[model samples]
Target: DCKKAVSGKSFYAMEGKPVCPKCVGVDEEEEEEEEA
Candidate 1:
């Protein structure tokens, strides 16, 4: 599950979720494909 962080700007963003390195690598690949 994701946690929410309250910032001074009045916007709550998702936080405190740990991501695996493999997932990050896959996300990078997807972004590269989109840029291409």
Candidate 2:
């Protein structure tokens, strides 16, 4: 999972949750492929 910094803490954006900017691209690609 991609780690995001929030108030100096680490965050992991899951598959369905609202993804952090660093993870958006990767998640989008996988999501679209899975739906197809």
TM-score of model number 2: 0.21
TM-score for candidate 1, please give it: 0.24
Residue pairs with clashing backbones, model 1: none
**Candidate models: Cα lDDT each:** 0.36, 0.47
Count the clashes in each prediction: 0, 0
Candidate that would win on TM-score: 1
**Pairs that collide, model 2:** none
Please, what are the lDDT tens digits per residue for candidate 2 over residues 1-36? 545644533334567554455455443223435543
Error of 1 at 14 (Å): 9.0
Per-residue C-alpha lDDT of model 1 across residues 1-36, encoded as one tens digit per residue: 423343332332225455443333333223445543
> Candidate 2: how many backbone clashes?
0
